[model samples]
Target: MTEVRGRMWVRGEPADGFTFSAISDCLTSEDTLVWADIYDPDHDTLTALAEELKLNMWAVEDATAPNERTKATVYRTHTFFTVYAIQMLTAVGDSTSTLVKHRISAFVLPRGLITVRLPPVAGDDPGFGMDEVSQRFDELGGQQYGVGALVHGLLDVVVDGHFDAVQDLDDGIESLEDELFDEDGPKRGLQRRTFRYRKDLVELRRVVLPMREVVSAIKSRRLDAKTSPELNPLYDDLYDHVLRASEWTESLRDMVTTVFETNLSLQDARLNTVMKKLTGWAAIIAVPTAITGFYGQNVEYPGLNTVAGFVVSSALIVLLVAVLYVMFRKRDWL
Candidate 1:
């Protein structure tokens, strides 16, 4: 019931309410191109569209399933593309934001473009930003370029998302770098934050890395509705954005790794400093213990068992410890 069809752009003229039931009716003139947007369709609805549109059964299966990796698969009459649209949620304190991937599947048919958006998942799943996608489509106005225009607009939206997510991750890494040096910052949280960055980047990279192949597959003119030579420049621009996102993420992953290793090094240095201070103090205290043991011997030569000898021994112990203390303090070993 949430399903809705967008106003069709035929050549340069706009028409509305081209339902799936009536899809068999002629919507495509030589210059007419139909674009349909479906949201969270039920099983019966998908089956019905598949029957009417002659969508490949395997492609329909993949469309309904969640968690499909980003890919492009070519069918006889249509090409199916699986792509993710990303939305970020900010976390509390110094931690980086969370990334929510909304799964989107598209079928590039000969005469039209069909976009199927999965429903929002539980928790902080930011549903696909349909408004931005719609705004991009609306920009077509009178310059409709058939199905190519629709596919271009939609892919443009998705690629921009990848770029934004990568940039946000870069910013998060920069913030983490600042806290890494701060003396008063929470050491434990910094460690956890870096780990989070590594994890998030891995996930982001997984989603983003395949986008190059997906976009390239389309730009290479393998699909029925692949970019025309006129639209090749646009697809090339999109490919450039994809490449930048992929490369930036690669460098960020290494940065996160460095942060983790540097934290370990810092911790080891701190432990060594603490252990050195403890050993110096223990050495200073041992001088008194050894003097007392010497004085307690049964057979002694110098003033054995006398009050004057006891005072002299005590004074010598105090003077020796004081000298050691001064030396240790001056050397900063205590």
Candidate 2:
């Protein structure tokens, strides 16, 4: 099983793991700043945290659920946020078929922050990069940073993930375009990939758009007094990042739609080409069919008795078909 525990960061230093009994001790510790990070804790641990931190039951429930929508909530003394971090795979083998997303729940209190990360399932570790943000927070000296800064740093990582996923999508689209236009290639695979990419973009937008509101709420300073005024700028910076990410997602969605439309148009053009070829052959054969039917009639006909007449009739039919074919070719309809 994946291990779960809480680590306390105080004034750029990490305290050993904090247990239930240690909670009050750590809370009373003489640290200018302290953060409690919980990694995939059990229900009991969540309950204890909820009680100790005075977090709303609903917020704790949402935190434990994996499919919770990206959102922000203001508790009596803390702000909670749920954010999604995306990881894209573009490998050529079995790895290529899998897409992984990491959903992280964050709780920001007046004196501390809590991050709960769920471990990846077997064969599906897309890996999270929370360490980088934690390191940066530590390096900056945690006391100087408020909960808003912590939230911003974490969100920055998440948005960076979005940027990387979008870049991967862009590269995938370019490859798909190449395959679609290749003269001797089959386009079905490219078309399928386009549809899949469009779906991915849609899902990405679903997760990202709500996050815009979450960041906006923080930047607007809607949180209670537990949130510091100095941290408003940090939230503002995060809001800008969310705006940029939203714009990028919209642009990518448009690009995916364009690719899908282009693929459909190509398919339609191909179908039309096939139909034209069949129609042209049918027209050519119709000329011979009519001539043979008329000449083969039982009644005495002007061209029926003479071999020369038969040859002339046949030549006329062939000549008519050849001329029609050339006309169609010149008109660019064949």
Candidate 3:
């Protein structure tokens, strides 16, 4: 399914009757800017659009290719790049959350910006919504700064989504930490949850870490007048978000690792305590066995075949067992 929608702004105000065919005419004026959003475009649609926009064929392929890494490539005519918007999915009754990636590729030109929204590789990911991006562009005064405002609005939404996903993962990790120490907490479940969280964090880091490079590539190219001086701080601020998200992801990876290792250590400690208690009980049992065995011998030194002897042997057994029980109890071995 191919869906195309866009608007043209002339002299910082929206121009009516905007269409793909009119892009060339709209760009004739230095003050005119275009923002086109294409969703799930097929090869035929892209090929035709590419012919019209003079987009690099390789860049078009990268846009539609499955699992393209987050990156930016500058061509002689324009800059092409890919980025992922993240969605964190947590199932009902699931202690851990899963990360879903939505691929958003774009071509940054001097007077126009074309964004491609691809379907998610898996899961029900609501890919990036360009309506919100459009609204954001307007909110940021895209009419005044031209393409720079549009680019900032687009990336601002993306980076904000990344922040939200990171926060979700952080919450999941904290919940897992709470479960780790609870005496009645899920024993086997804790291990499974930690593994799941670690896996999610890895996926998140893959999607997040590369954003720094992508954003930097945009700033360095400067692409004619795409970004004005007013938008520099905005992009810099967006870049900071990318950096913070990257660092937060790194920290989370380490945190989940520690949680996994700590779970193992706690299990080992519990096992040792169990073994010690068993050993104490075994030692207490051996005392009675040894005392009776001595009395049972055919030529026993004492306590043989007499009422008085029977009482004496029984007394010895009771006294020794009682003493051992008290000692073990005091040491928390019972």
Candidate 4:
């Protein structure tokens, strides 16, 4: 079922409950910031809201488009911004888990914010939504900025979600590194785990790298009064986080690749060591086989068919075998 999550904040406090259709009534002052959130709404619902809000039809179409890159677009009266919130990536129930990119498009008006969320149909939960974002607004009760503060809160939550995912990936990589050297840990799942981590890092980089440009555009374009001078510090902090998330993901990818290569090298070295032992033992055994075969020949040869000669040949075989065994063992080929 589709859900519409929204709130009206007046004078930095949440006003009484109001419907999305009555959004215009909420914009009573320069201090008012109206936020409306919808998830996977039908065409009729979106069309009605677009007409009600006077939003550009082209921006609405882009919002409803199936796939969108993280970007910011300017319109005559407002700006359209699209961003993503990361859900998670994990192993669940033998299926291929995915990195959930919860696409959220925003209509940044001078005094209002309208958001549309395109979440996966199933199992892509990161336990965050507009309710959480609205709380950030309410938490700042009695302090008023404008639409810029609200936009910063939204982007902050999204970027913070990516930060958490990056931290989780780092922990997984650390644990895998430990298990790589552990002798008793189960070895069967290491390959799958490493591959999943690498895949997730790639996906994360795709999502996070573009965010730097998105925020910078919003900060620089000064879309209407939405880019207030007071918001400079907050947006600057958010840009720093985006930079950190992108750099961390690349470093983690390199680490995972190194671990995977080192594991293969260790396996090959072990195989070579086993082969050396087998070859050394084969050489030691061939000495006895050659002496017995020569002695058992039907024709006469030296040291055959006589007790004294047989004893001397037997001693000769034992001495040669012992000498070879000592040499091989000294060379660590046993």
Query: What are the TM-scores, per candidate, against the unseen true structure?
Result: 0.87, 0.82, 0.92, 0.88
Off by over 4 Å in 1: 24-27, 92-97, 140-143, 222-228, 292-315, 326-332
Encode model 1's per-residue lDDT on 193-279: one tens digit a residue.
Answer: 887788889999999999999989877754433434567677789899899889999999999898888878877877887898998
Put down candidate 2 lDDT per residue, 1-334, tens digits, no spaces: 3344445666645666666456556655546344555666788878886887678888888988867888888766778888888887765542133346788888776656678777765455756757776765655453444555666667777887887887787787778778777897555566657767777788888887888888776565543225356666666777777778788889888887887788789889988988988888788789889988888888986766899887999898989999989987886667
Winner on lDDT between 3 and 4 is 3
- Name the runs in model 3 displaced over 4 angstroms: 92-97, 185-187, 224-227, 293-301
Native-structure RMSD, model 2:
3.6
Candidate ordering by TM-score (highest first): 3, 4, 1, 2
Q: What is the per-residue lDDT of model 3 for residues 1-334, given as tens digits with 9 covering 90 to 100?
A: 7888998888889878788777767766698888888888889988887887788999999999987899999999989989988877665434545677788999988888899988665545556567777888878874677677788888888898899999998998898888788987545677878888888888888889999999998977867444478778888999999999999999999999999998888889888889989999898889879978888788857546889987887788889889989998999888
Per-model lDDT: 0.79, 0.72, 0.84, 0.79
Clashing pairs in 2: none
Alpha carbon lDDT at 157, candidate 2: 77
Clashes of each: 0, 0, 0, 0
Superposed Cα deviation of residue 31, candidate 3 (Å): 2.6
1 versus 3: better lDDT goes to? 3
